[model samples]
Target: MKDATQTIRRATFAYSQLYARTAAREIKHPVEGVVQGEIPRWLRGSFLVNGPGQASVGPDRYRHAFDGLALLREFILSDGRAWYRHRFLQSETFQRNHRDGRIVVSEFGTAASANPCGGVLQRFISHLSLVGDFTDNALVNVTPIGDQLCALTESPFLHRVDARTLDTMGRSDLRNVASLHTIAAHPHTYDGCTYLVGTRFTPPRPKYVILRFPKSEEMNGCKSFLESARVMAEVPMSSRLYPSYIHSFAITENWLVLLEQSLIINLPRLLLSKPMGAQGFVSCMKFDPERKTRFHIVDRKTGALHSANIETEPLFVFHHVNAFEQQGSQEVVIDVCAYVDDALIRSMYVYFDGWTPKTRFAQVRRFVLRLQPGRSSVSSQLIRPMRSFCEGGLRGDMPRINELFNGRPYRYAYLLSQADDHREDDIFLSKLDLDSGRWLRWHCADWVPSEPVMVPRPGSEAEDDGVLLSPLVHASDECRRALVVVDATTFRQLAFVEFFTDCAAPATFHGCFVQAP
Candidate 1:
């Protein structure tokens, strides 16, 4: 154990600053950037992203990176100039902690602080009441519903923030619209409505609910769009006591594609565990290798679920690139960043504590699901044979494609990729050719990149005719980060703008580029 511990410490010592705690600051006005190259004349929009900003309150800190508060950043580019700003989302939890100077709500991996004046028994009772009350720190992703931008997490609470000012306007609970205990953070906005998948933990009949929130025009005297939410379909739980942890799902023209993996949440353990310091909700999750992962596809027009049993090997997935139906067949194709197991979750805690597990690389795997009207069993396949991670191929995560081709057939995918030799920490922006199996990369030495967001050029029909937007941070410098614009066709850097700020600009998870008028 001693020798194994030493290996992990040495391997991850240099990357500790990636998760370092930092102060939050908001630039009220857009500051002009020092442009390194000519900005695209036609590029006009705001690139908005969200992630954890502050990780601690007073002297107590969150145990995991996901427990931090939400921070929203934006970069607007038009003509030949760019502007930038960032602000912290003032949720109920953020305001309560700021007003009281301590954490009073439980996050995903961090328990709330015990009351200072309460006795042991009193504090124990308080903790028991908060075991099921998760925090409202919607730090994962941002989505646009009508004219409002909604910040979301795995909790039932969603906060609406002003797009221009980045201020929290109000909050809405999905449980009011449906009997949902927790919701998947990644919701699909297609046609005129937003679709979400939520889980209800009602005993003896735990189920997953597919919800749809209508557009603002269709809402009838509703203050919030979620108030007019309606159920599209329902899927029964694979296991009565445990439901799989779903971060994101995908959609096609006629079906909602969801993967039920082996990583499960123990409902009894989570609801009964004492919510205290150092004992978080993430500890209650267990991955069972004996069970097979299953796929649940629901019809979009009708509220009917496919009865065919579709199962695959036991695996783990955080995000799905895209899912679409074949042009002229009864089949659907899903591309995702998949892992062999859930060991990557342990590597996240290694920075706070000196413990590491064997991690695997996230590969872009394509699964084909064949649907037949009369077939009893559905068939699925991993197009490529399982190979060693050390092989020279596409090893990356945060896969993205052009928004125009999101639910249809496409040819290109953008992602943050590891080096060819498969070094875990080394990363660069890469463009993948789905048909030719060719890979193109844009690398800046000693700098790491966040997820790549592809913005199509105005009036372009080609899938790869666009630019990739990614934020770059220096690996060694704590106060350095920049946004780089790369030509998607050439996969070369067009320009980069470094922002001036007092606080460090940390890495963000997922964001979208909205074109300005």
Candidate 2:
């Protein structure tokens, strides 16, 4: 038991620096980055990243690492020169909290003060109405919706921001176009059409609504794109009373792959819980190991759901690496970083003082679902089995791949990785060769890295002929961070622009590299 505790402590020690509370700062002016090596002249565009930045307000602090306000960071590479800037989103929740010197909005795991509710009765009434205001903290991801770059969260709210200025321009609600209560932050774009899945927790039965909108090549206003959104299909949940909590979904050329996992959201507990207690969104969720994780594939055009029973062991997943349809075969392949249960979510709560909880890791697994056209059951198998990193398995999360190969057959993937039972400095940036079943990793001692965003070189025929941009947070008192650029083909660091003092970048979740036209 002592050795097990030490292993946990060693693995989490350096990675824990990412959860530290960071002060929000807006570097409105773009500052030239001191290049350590020659940056690719072809690498021109902005590498935009977003995540929870400030986790505290006044004397109060959030209980979960995900409850921080949204902060946007941009690294512009152009003409063989690089520039950097950052800013916090000016959401209504942020404004209210900063103006009043207290938390005025409830977050994913942090409950606001009782003063905001005008007493306990109003809070109860608000929860019972099921129309309680959803938070607008778009701290999860940044992607383009039509011609506009927007920041998105699990809530129905998505904020449009100026990509060049990193300033919030406007906010739009998915509820305006559909009856969606929440949505997956990860949206897939293929063949000039963007696709997303939203869960509408309505009365008779909760349904997952698949939405699609055309990707506008020209600026058509912020709201015009979402207004173009139309419902493609709707799949009813396996259970009406308890709907699975979905963080992300997958897409193929002809179908949207939805996973009904075991992590359920109890409607009764969600609505009856008080808003000013230690309980947050996590407290209302329960994971059932007995339930099987089912897969429902919906046709992209016909809105027809495959009636075959496709299921696997109960698991929890937050992101889907990618999915592709097999050519000349009726099969869809999906790759995901999955855990045995929801223990990883509980490990992410922010603990005050010198206490740290045991951490849980994930393993990359692939599932191939064979469609039986006229049968009631579909055959599925775990093509890539789960094992510890020491056993040559891909243990990682926050995955990225070449955008050009999205919803299509692809080979390579990049992620922040770590060994299962290694020391504190075992974390690294890993490249998984899907075809070869091999792993290549890049490491820098004592510097925890974020997601690797692949930027494919223009006019390149090869899939990985580009660079990878990853933000690094140093686990030292020097107050330093860096943007490390690596050659995606060789999986080696080419150059890095280090930031120190006030310009240090905070830890980030997901980002994208938008090449300049």
Candidate 3:
């Protein structure tokens, strides 16, 4: 149990120190100019990204990947020039551990050291600190809701930041609007509403609520949050003790599809396990090989839930590629990066230890759901699956598709992959053609890639008519970081703005490009 968890902590520290070393620093000074290549004139926006930067709080290092403190970076792209700014997302945990000098609060998966005083006060302080309520670091992703840039974790709250500058504004408490304390990092933003799942833990049955937050210029990240949040649907789960771990979902023309994978989190253990000297969130649950994966298909317009539950060989899924309803049929094709077993989640604990977990790579497969109207019965099958040509590595993550074809049929998916499974240190930026069984890949010798973001060319008519912006990092210790842009249709290099700081940034998870207004 401790081996995998222990390995991850050691790996994070070693990786951060060896290559892209990071430290907590918030400065808005003019960037040190070492940029290469030209900036596309049509590219006009701020690319805001978030990820863990502080690997250790003091001499005491973080025990889990999720335990590291969140860092936010903002790159302003306009007129063929870029300005860079970075800041750490302010958290109660960071204040208590890093600044004030004590690791008193336990993180999502990593438990803190016992209080100096091992009496009733220690127990009291422990319970006072909720598991993910306020203490969870929102390092996973960033969502631009209305006028606010929201830094997100699986936790309910969204930490707000000033868009223009990477300044930590405050936290937008979702408890005021939705009862659910947990949600996936991925939210689908449509015409004016951001569609996301808000799940709550209640007695007997836990409810998953579809929250549609209406966007307005007036929604400036402070007030009337609930008034703008419309509850689209609320579906109850089968298990009361566990909650499903979902990183993302899918949307089609008329339906919003959510796949509750076999990975179930133990809520009771997350609440009580720390008291028993056990790890928090990640340690509390076990993978259920018996249970079937569920597909909760909800009507986007009518808010009717078709619990079109289906059964198939169990697999673990984190990111979704895309989903669209098939023409002239009651079928929806959903693409996801699926792992054969729970090793990927478990390997989050073991990656650093040099012990290879079997299912680290995930294969990108399409699951077609055939839904029956009245009863909502459904069946699924895998479509033309995509695999990496490098060393039998087929797993994919950090999936991205064109926003224009989000709820419609899409032809391409952009994500990170690897060629050699044995040497897992490398990364390849891959663009998959869904229409044709082919993929285009870009790899730099020692350089790894971050989540690739797509920015459509102005007045572009073709679906693939856009530019791909990804963090090209670790080209070498000397040339630590660069934001590389590539042609979407051809997957060729367009331009890149590099970062030449004393301290290089760690891996980034997710971000959104906000077009300059």
Best by TM-score: 1
Measured with C-alpha atoms, the lDDT of residue 349 in candidate 1 is 51
User: Per-residue error at 454 for model 3, in Å?
Assistant: 0.9
Write model 2 residue lDDT over 317-377, tens digit each, in one string.
Answer: 8988899988443788888888888877887776546766555457878888777665676
- The estimated TM-scores of all candidates read 0.92, 0.91, 0.88
- Model 1, which residues run further than 4 Å from truth? 1-17, 275-278, 327-329, 355-360, 378-391
Residue 438's lDDT within candidate 2 is 84
Number of backbone clashes in candidate 1: 0
Error in Å for residue 341 of model 3:
2.0
Q: Compute the lDDT of residue 387 as modeled in candidate 2.
A: 34
Number of clashing residue pairs, candidate 3: 4
Residues 38-134 of candidate 3 have per-residue lDDT tens digits of: 7788888888888877766555556565667888877778888887777888866667776536555666556676555469876656654544535
TM-score for candidate 2, residues paired by index: 0.91
Better of 1 and 3 by TM-score: 1
Candidate 2 or 1, higher TM-score: 1
CA RMSD of all predictions? 4.9, 4.4, 5.8
Worst 10 residues of 2 by lDDT: 1-10
Poorly placed runs, candidate 3 (over 4 Å): 1-21, 117-133, 215-227, 349-359, 376-394, 420-422, 475-479
Candidate 1 clash pair list:
none
